[model samples]
Target: MAVISNSLQIKHGLSLWCPQSASINRTHRRSSIGLGRVLRRSYVAASSAFANENREFVIVGGGNAAGYAARTFVEHGMADGRLCIVSKEAYAPYERPALTKAYLFPLDKKPARLPGFHTCVGSGGERQTADWYKEKGIEMFYEDPVTSIDIEKQTLTTNSGKQLKYGSLIIATGCTASRFPEKIGGNLPGVHYIRDVADANLLVSSLERAWKVVIVGGGYIGMEVAAAAVGWKLDTTIIFPENHLLQRLFTPSLSRRYEELYQENGVKFLKGASIKNLEAGSDGRVTAVKLEDGSNIEADTVIIGIGAKPAVSPFESVGLNTSVGGIQVDGQFRTSIPGIFAVGDVAAFPLKMYDRIARVEHVDHARRSAQHCIKALLSAQTHTYDYLPYFYSRVFEYEGSPRKIWWQFFGDNVGETIEIGDFDPKIATFWIESGKLKGVLVESGSTEDFQLLPKLARSQPFVDKAKLQNASSVEEALDIARASLTS
Candidate 1:
């Protein structure tokens, strides 16, 4: 039997066909091998594409916003991909506010140190272990700093030269403490800024050995730190350039209230003061701080809780617009850059009620913002981030007396704050606006009032201001508020 073969070739303007015999078998074998190689390449390409398709949602920063975002996404069934959270810190995301208060207290009082099963404990116990993220199928890259973002290419490059592609990206980068320049001895071993768990730990360690601690900045952070230090029986003094604490955020009267709280707890206040120079010992530990008033205060440790600047460098590098030291996002938490969203302390969002853009660093804000972002991501709906801001700080006493609690609320169009339950000038005050309950200032009078404030704030149609103030007891006031809201 004779085998027949045909060779066909086509050129620019010509075609040729030749019939052959012996070469046909060899040609057929080569063609089969070539086809197999093409198929294999296609299969491998498809596999690569599949792997890329399964790439997780990438979130920068492992703070409250990032953790809340991860949890929200998982709860909404949007936790596909790897849900990678890259944090510069080695530990998982922990409660930051608690760091300055509870964590600084004795082990028994610190929530993180409590041994029993607590609902607040994430996948692992406190201290933000990675297992929490792992439990939610989230991947964490700790101690990894994202250096640059390639927006056009949808890629991020780390400082270590690693590149990651993201299907969706969230810039919850949070913020960093505003440090004084090294020339002013800001970088000294004894000078510390509180922004993370590590900083708190360092401060705690320093407090152990120090006899006197001077905290610069009379903002909430500094005041909270002072309260914590004083609670631990340390001689602590707070230096505030302003006449009051949280002057930037609250009215003079409110700030004065905070000042009084700290003072009552045996924390010294140096208002309208500045640090002239940090006197150091031979061992490089801060021995004292020279004040601008020509008076030198002995300071074993100096904590600078001056303020914070948004951690928006990565987003800025990607050409995402920012304002008020935070990434500007639209109603849906979508940044000016497409495929990117931001939230928490690092996101400047429009406040319809206040008719301005506001950025709050409270945990509630972080949680609500993350929830809004997650809802938007899942439903593809456009919802404005318009939750009212609320925050609280724990006040501890130097003596054996009970720790006082202070809380504030800011409202718009709400009317007349009502005072109830003895209206102790040193304890608590309720702010009622427009016949509606608005703000509650609590020191030690009622825990119920503190808990009820947030609920009423959200429920709107707040408590009956008249009835609340006229009520004989906190329980009566709460019942009136609940009834008013329901009615």
Candidate 2:
């Protein structure tokens, strides 16, 4: 709530808002030892008098990871005035994925709203609202983000000039949405970017009055917004530098299928486009998008969804994984500093299943890593973090569409791809390397079919490309992949 001159502008909850592939770096694995000895120091340490009140567990972010971490602490019988959450937003942590998904749906669709989509609920757990934290004895510091973190002394100072020390610290500060420099009208009134509930609220206000919507990225944010814009009956156009959408994940064929679907729903596309600058009207709001090719698209609202990077400014002195763009942590989410931990998009931890260090930007990793970190901290879990990359989205429900526009992908999207299905009722894409299934993506899959991808991808089953490609339906193809795990 207090604005200060000496504070880092590290945005919170951006990952849970955007939840896209911001940056992914695969590196050598790491080893962790002596965690128990270090964490046993407790809140009553040598520097106990540094702060008026020291919490045993202080989570620096109130995003999905922070909210879930609080729930995990309460579940483990640890929330007896020993846990606290410091957040940059006035509201407590809620499910951020809704900002682009159900939150953007047409008003008639009864889109998701606050108090109903808080953390843990996104993962089928209990909803932990603001009052829930009070009921469970968890301290809440809303709208006060920690600006400075002292790793050696194990203390952090908030922007409101509040000093707090922690026995065990969680640096869950998620990410910040990437934006254009203000020289190019990036700061124009109608040129918007969504990274939290506040950002979404402003965008919703713009949408209510806008006649045309211009989305300036092909990734998750642009695609999802495009779908929502069409639903609202606005003139929607998606412009991106890539030849196809979701360039990071979708195969050419896979991208084509979704592009066709979007086209059928009245969304326009200007693929492989480069933006020169945003043109502002006399009223000082974004009015048009100028392209490098001497073309201009008139627009009343612009949504920027280029990408995001980890919000790790306050803790950079603690030796982060610079190559991976986040705080470096071991499998147990322990930073180089003994009593500190990092989770969610900000922690570049070892992905044991892949034998490489990766910083995953997704809700699933956020929920699982928070629970795993707390368990490891409480001495209930011993194993390292073994995570398989998973991403999924469901968009578009127009007047005549009965088919569910949904897809789930598991594992890495490397290696040669095999695009299957008829695209009429189903579409499946498999990534194969050395005749083994490395990843699987399927649209309009069944409940049973969706369950097989994680299993098949983790096992990396040796598969026959011909057998999989020739399978009749999504169920049949996934059935073949499921069998290959044992064969």
Candidate 3:
């Protein structure tokens, strides 16, 4: 077949089809080839016309969203349609959140492995394995990523030269971790990132011999890694340009509360400082980290968690509407193109509750958005995606302490004024704008209390400043808000 920059195809006259020769046997054969080899060596010679004639549905990613979409499809009586999932990952969709948390837990804690953290299981559903796919007549293309897509032609070409056409497509490409320039020692042997299971495994292995570890960025990933490192008895230091942890999200009081807790756990913090360059030994392994403030700290391992950017290359050649965040999707998770949908971190969707468009990178969003997209596809439903913004972070626990510092936030945290309830073991903040409650945040709150906060925020109840100032507890404020709805 002719290739145009390994992406576009100018052969408009070509028809679409999917030959039965590409189907796997019912015996469930597993390929032993490594992902790198499969992408480079294994080739599938199918034309776009052949694929289109056969395929009914196709998903372009293998993360949380893809996994849930598969479950949604099968649940909705889609047992026999030709469904295919193309993914660069060798493993099936597993819990992406565990990589930065439980997967890094001490060996005694027994970190999760394949089949354990698989999709649908996170949402109390069945774990669909390779055998499950076979039983359902679904085909999976692992380690072979789609290098290009022809939207008008409804075709996808993988890195291995396999081509397929679909009646409907779901894009769940997820996001990529951010790193520093290679000139600054970002490519050193001990430098690490945690975006997938492979990255977490590598970092976990490094922790066994790591004494002094440097963590970059103050985002939840950096904070969580620091908590785990110190919990494992390693010397951990966090460096970020922000004056406090979670500077972009948490207020000064909440940041200080968590920062103090981290310090109490013996984790050092180097705030308001950026990495000048990484120092390495003759062997090219990192040895130390130099800060922009003219200070150097010993580092046996380094973890970078600066941020993430949407994985949008597969959609680039398709001329889809995109923003700096990700592919812009409607309330139903449909893209600008017909019969196409985008979800999870790669989709910048409209947040109806906030009357604004935003993209969330959390696992909850991934699971819900995928389910919504599948509903819209299978039923032609015009349901509006009204998702309440929610996120949480769990940090360190000292020796002999069974307590874990965890916090969950719901609704929008942006407002003209903020009110606090308490800041000890429990930290609660309410964001108010023009006497209207806009958001609620709480740390170490009970399940009932946490659940009530979001409902109150969604109600957008009118508030009196005097009642907020005189409120004894979060529960009291919740009671007042609840009464307002009734009154």
Q: Give per-model TM-scores.
A: 0.77, 0.90, 0.86
Please report, in order, the local distance difference test score of every candidate based on alpha carbons: 0.63, 0.79, 0.74
- What tens-digit string does per-residue lDDT give for candidate 3 at 1-487? 0010111111111111101001111111112321222111112224645733446778889899998988888888874556888898888887788788777877766656777888878878888777787788878899999898876566788999987877677889888887878999998999998888788889999998888999998877888888888768889999999889876667887788888888887889998897899999988899999988788999989999888877888796433333335776677776655566788888767677765566778888899999988887677565688987777776554344445887777766666645456556576777777788877777788888777877877888887767876778767766776676666
Total backbone collisions for each predicted model: 11, 0, 9
Q: The CA-based lDDT of model 2 is what?
A: 0.79
lDDT of 1: 0.63
Our tally of clashes for model 1 stands at: 11
TM-score of 1: 0.77
Candidate 2 accuracy as TM-score: 0.90
- For candidate 3, give the lDDT: 0.74
Query: Can you rank all candidates by TM-score, best first?
Result: 2, 3, 1
Best by TM-score: 2
Candidate 3 Cα errors over 4 Å, as ranges: 1-53, 79-81, 319-323, 397-402, 416-422
Best by lDDT: 2
Root-mean-square deviation of Cα positions for candidate 3 versus the true structure, in angstroms: 10.6
How many backbone clashes are present in model 3?
Answer: 9
